[model samples]
Target: MTNAHELGLPERVPAGDDLPAEVTVWEVGPRDGLQNESSVVPVEVKLEFIDRLADAGLTTIEATSFVHPKWVPQLADAEPLLAGLTRRAGVRYPVLVPNERGLDRALAAGVEHIAIFASATETFANRNLNRTLDEQFAMFEPVVSRAVAEGLDVRGYVSMCFGDPWEGVVDRAAVVAVGRRLLDLGCSQLSLGDTIGVATAGQVGALLDDFAAAGTPTSALAVHFHDTYGQALTNTLAALRHGVSTVDSSAGGLGGCPFAGSATGNLATEDLVWLLEGLGVRTGVDLDRLADTSVWLAGELGRPSPSRVVAALRG
Candidate 1:
């Protein structure tokens, strides 16, 4: 394979106004990326994929979900996968815990970090969590509280923050209210998800401004964008301009909302790294290794990666 450097990296430009000095690339491939797969990836392969990600310098890697196997059979081997992991010193392996039962499994597996998925719209709450919008918080309250009490770092994911398939447009106030509630419930950070990828750059800036107006600092928030509408990179840039340092991405553009058919793959990590590297922002990610890792996983999944950076560099 040709070296990524041989193809030349993006030219570094002076850091723009309000852009963070450094960004945290939260890798969600092993969990979110593979959860949508039709075929189950073996536990051993999952382990290797995660190890490769850590080696590639991703400090925070979301390992797997503890959701019921009946719901996400693709990650049914979460326990074994977690057990087989060879953890790095400064790298974190967080898992998704749906509720109390999932929390129990994660605690038993010695997980130090966990993320909970929530919805901003009534329709999405009903469709995804089988609960009304208001009632969904009730379910998460106990989970967050318990996780916080256990001294585990908790991340709250608010999906459909931009747009929902069932619902046409989501209100900014509604998203802010949900995020504030999560923060109040002891979640350390809230990840705003464009679950269906319908948001534009303007929408991204407007939402982040609203969160700030509501007293939620950018440090307590993260952005997770999908590339369905080809706006993921643009939207991510807007978020960065608003001082959001932590960005969630999947390696190789591998994930979408499993509950929402309209949703597509996430903002690819390799793509994000390329952009940040060009902007002179440090993300501590090796773009070449990340692209290669994605390429390897694509082969395992029997498909080409949808990431543009991966394609461009690999070619």
Candidate 2:
């Protein structure tokens, strides 16, 4: 598939159209990116990375996960990180919580926003969470309820929304069912994740159409894509054309899904910024600074970033 840049598309797609003029980038580098790395990054480095992201004008950043250290040891210091963080006005820091216990830790850390993850496929649910789909929802009920009661903004993540490694070609209806359940549980927004990076533009459009038909507004949805097959930017454009305003990406294409061995790093925030700028979409992010941040992070990771934009800039 040809990318938007390759097609020589116009800079601006005219206002008052189906596409939105502005987009919100939910940066997940500090959490999702680092969790998958083999080496454990220090708390100070993690804090600095997050600070740099906010400094680059990323408004929403996923700081870390509250899951047990047994599962994600890298982010075990979620509490300390939150406590030491320099909170900024109009900037949101969200943490991932697996259960009520995780929620408690997050609340104690003064986390104002949290995210819960679920799977659209049974295989992934069992492998990733060790629970059946129904059992997982049962586990999330009280967690979501408690978080909402505490006035915390809850975001739900539905993984393997398009195709699963174990089970191929997931039905659109199945994805919508899980998404609706999350919204029913009082989740303020749901992020649809292409965990294996197997989605095409047509598949993305069809799934969004199903969600819209099921009464889930596009405004309450965010799209997370992996660039394993080199389609992340194209898929994101498809989502934007369908009126999705929020996108979940990682700086420098930093991480991949540990559960899905075949997966690669996520859509690069720098690349997304490049595309959005060319399309005249406002993201409030400085593309050059964001790329420089990625380069610095890559040095800390002891490797080069996988982001195309970053590589080009370095050249």
Q: Which candidate ranks first by lDDT, i.e. highest?
A: 1
RMSD, candidate 2, Å: 3.7
The sequence of per-residue lDDT tens digits that candidate 1 reaches over residues 141-256 is: 88888999999999999999989887788999999999999899999999999999999999999999999998888899999999998999999999999999999999999988
The TM-scores, one per candidate, come to 0.97, 0.95
Best by TM-score: 1
TM-score of 2: 0.95
lDDT of 2: 0.92
* Local accuracy of candidate 2 as per-residue lDDT tens digits, 1-315: 876545333255444466788999999999999999997998999999999999999999999999999988888888888889999999999999999999999988999999999999899999999999889999999999999999999999999999999999999999999999999999999999999999999999999999999998899999999998899999999999999999999999989888899889999998898888777898999777888899999999899999988888764
Cα deviation at 278, candidate 1, in Å, is 0.1
Pick out the ten consecutive residues of candidate 2 with the lowest summed lDDT.
7-16
